[model samples]
Target chain A: MSIPITESITVIDTTLRDGLQIEDRVVPTALKVEIARALVDAGFRHLEIGSFVNPKKVPQMADTAELYRELGSLEDEGVTLYSLVFNAKGAQRAVDAGALQVKLVISASEGHSRSNSDSSIAQAGDRLLAAIQVLKANNVAFEVGTAVSFICPIDGPTPPQNLVSILEPLVAEGAAGVGVADTIGNANPRMVRTGTKAVQQAFPDMPITVHLHDTYNFGIANVVTTLEMGITRFDATLGGLGGCPFAPGAAGNIGSDDLIHLLHREGYSTGIDTEKLAGIRPTLTRAIGHPLSSKLSTIPAVPEPAPIGRASR
Target chain B: MSIPITESITVIDTTLRDGLQIEDRVVPTALKVEIARALVDAGFRHLEIGSFVNPKKVPQMADTAELYRELGSLEDEGVTLYSLVFNAKGAQRAVDAGALQVKLVISASEGHSRSNSDSSIAQAGDRLLAAIQVLKANNVAFEVGTAVSFICPIDGPTPPQNLVSILEPLVAEGAAGVGVADTIGNANPRMVRTGTKAVQQAFPDMPITVHLHDTYNFGIANVVTTLEMGITRFDATLGGLGGCPFAPGAAGNIGSDDLIHLLHREGYSTGIDTEKLAGIRPTLTRAIGHPLSSKLSTIPAVPEPAPIGRASR
Candidate 1:
């Protein structure tokens, strides 16, 4: 029997934000804008440019507001730019910067919540309520996402109830969508399937996106598993850049180039031109100042001049 | 809503044979025996030690006979050791070395067959027919395997019909089992699912094993897809050791260490102790004179003191 494949999936390029958020060298605003424009030109409509965290804490993303202002022209092109916001203050910063969409992120595990947000999951949720209200007041569209939704570095595996409870307020307040992330790049496919399914069952109508890191080389496998569960959205970074400062052992996010290759090979229409995507990788490589870890970054693209062996048949 | 996982799977460690075949340095015979011994102690019942090919062409595998002699005692312990044979002479060499079992491999694609064996598929099959007769005369159990069963390096994809056509003679000869190899590690899950399903349908009673390379980081994903197709057997190399000399762009076999980690995380029993398996990696690394490419080889094992997250729930 064949896997029931979804015809198409939406890819949100998080290169400028998650891909560069943890890099040692802070990229200039102009370079970031250029990268975003390149991504948009390569057929990505949804892009996460930066997070609205404290500039003092995350210096790399200190220019989020500036980036929003710089990309104001992209908004007219039907581009939906997203920024991460944790509390009312961040939401206000996003609103003040003319942000149209924001993703409210909280850790589902107490351990991650303490380290990443300096609060427990409940405390974080309380803080996010204020952010939701601020986002509502500003009339900015918002979604809720959980960090370490499957496994936690300190607290260990997060129960599905933990995720559901963490998401209660956001889901109840009519968040536009939901996202679950493998914050540490450690969750297996089965965990993703179970956790995502739990969310799918609870909010059947909500658009769900999974953000994964290729820390264990299980990113694509997890993506395949989620696809089996009917998920049609994923978040990736260009040239596989990204890691969380708080998440130990986390590697780069799944490479947009590699993921698109898998999606296309599996007969899923991602509507992104891989050749054009590959063209932008050198800029990312220079921005990160290191060799990118995604498979496509290392290997030259094989020309499909003709189907080899049985593909011809 | 959860993924329907298989209860168990069989892992065949092919490090000694496939992993070391293409290395520039030829490891010592004693080291080969020690590695095989460590693998068996770690609960790997199946191990492919060496191939009975031209020793001059494959100098790294020149110690095949002596290594087999050294490991003869392992047969009494319920360990099944496999060596590859192509022609009647190679089959005779295996029998003379007291090989209880052998695997006859040929490329499913004409492109690979011409390059790897310096013969056409028809010519290779004619030679394999002689080898099969020799194996029967020697009372040695053997199985048939096809390299590049899905995608070929020179040729593109091998149609399912090509694989079936290649396996027809061996199946008619009553081969013990069948193995389909992604010789170049370029196959995506769709190709794997389609090609493997074709083989499975043709030989419903045949036990099939998949040999994959992690060239594109699709090894584990292909494993997951095949598992979903009810494929229970896989071949892997330790520390992700092994690549193809004939197949360009081939990286390493899906690291046995990494594959086992995925299988265990997905709740499948492989009967192999990962800790013990990991212990043997340093030795292989020393022998190979380089670091292994597997994810587990680079990272510390995640302590599963308790199943975290939704798995616990």
Candidate 2:
């Protein structure tokens, strides 16, 4: 039987970059490269390997250049390596490190902007536009990521119209597309559908990627709603790694294995073997020295059925 | 602007009974009564207050009779109090405790039956039939609750045909309705819609209640699908209080506040005041000796609009 939905969904694995940011334990540069290789081997088309932020604030991402260099030498032609950049300097650093795509993040909510970046919304927008210009001059592809686009911890619900107001100028400034991040993990499926609908209405042809956190546990549900809305791209972390150090009580991003399982079960092909994805859980657990918060990690592999009754008979 | 969907969906609060069963802490009888009264005050039409089970095994529900008597004496018109029973003896206890409706639970999955009830599926069916006979003889309004009706913890997914097989005999036994319980908290919205549709097809006129747990965090999502299928009656817990003790690692049931919020937002009138429901969270938290697991608990009442300054000012 031909399935209605095929394995056309793009998996953008952000375990090394975003996952390392929120994790309490600092993953070594070598482990980050190993994770990238594993993610590529697991058929991820996109891998966010690291961020180019200051080393003092985010120690886990200090070895970004070394990690990027290792991944760049890997023979995998299917993987498109990317990194996160908060400013023009970071964007320049990412381009120097040989990253094909550099993601620039700006907070849509003013409260989060002040808390996360110590900048106003307009200032952050200006920074993002400048960074996009720099990346363009360097011949690097870039996307403007709007963090806390759905609901902010301090600001509550973000009006969709305000989000559009921020996006229009960035798209004009050579941003390849816009990525909406649920930084506090509060967006429900309904909110996601409504928010995405609003953005899609404003930028009809703009490619949108949704970055979700599982804090309120609506991550996968929101992904399903987005899928129904014809959004085939999303960001997920291995073993559900990563949460914002600044965003208090924010849990990890949606688990990649859990996301794969949900999509596969719903008849949407994600081109991921869930069992193989789950195999990396132990490595993540040992690296973090604590149990990961993924449901799929704990479940024993479903045993195959034995041949019927010959021995008993 | 009038909304097309029905507003006054019936809220059946199942916290005291189903919720208590999943709790590790033994809630006192007074606290159970307090939760039950709070649920009624929150506009719940039906409340499953407690269960008549062996005190030794489920010590949390040791005072079912006292809890029922206290709630019965309130004489709250329009409120229907229910008690869950597992066998004929428990059914008699429920009826004697002045329960307006007595609910009996049996598993549709054979594996769940063996693990949960320590009996084969056939033996459990016989026990359920005996309990039904007892309820019928007393003319007590009764419902047969099929626990793990959607998916079994040990058996994985329960086939729709297996659910039909279980519901058929119960309908024949004059069951007023059958409830589908996501006992292990493993159901998705599609599974809920499919399972509910199958059972409804098998018994056209029978009332159905969808009891969900938030383990995988699809509780409210499944409820939305249930609503799309025109299922108005559902089981919820105040402050998302309960889970199954037998099913390890299951989270609390869908919070009544969150469910009411979703229904009201979708143009369905639940006759529940969102503010009042949120206010009850603290009381439940204090009684449970821990904070409740609801998203809406801390949401400040959506403040009324501030007055605009005069043009002269």
Give lDDT tens digits, candidate 2, residues A1-313: 1125465777788888888776678887777777677777777778888889988988888898888778886535867887888788888888788877788888877878998888899998887777777788888888876888876766766777777898888777777777888877766566667678888888888888889988755677678678778887899988777888766667788888777766765566776766667767777677778876655664544332122121111
DockQ: which candidate is best?
1
Tens digits of per-residue lDDT for model 1 on B5-108? 55878999999999999998899998898999999999999999999999989998888999888998899989999999999999999999999999999899
Give each model a TM-score. Answer: 0.96, 0.83
Query: How does chain B score by TM in each prediction?
Result: 0.96, 0.92
DockQ scores of all models, one per candidate: 0.52, 0.19
Predictions in order: lDDT: 0.88, 0.75
Task: Indicate the worst ten consecutive residues by lDDT in candidate 2 chain B.
Answer: B304-313
lDDT string for model 2 (B211-311, tens) is 88876556776776687687878888877878776666667788887777666645579877767777677777776787776656533343321111211
- Give Cα distance to truth, residue B277, candidate 2, Å: 6.2
TM-score of 1: 0.96
Give one digit per residue, the lDDT tens place, for model 1 in A50-140. 9998899899999999999999779899889999999999999999999988999999887788888787788889889999999998899
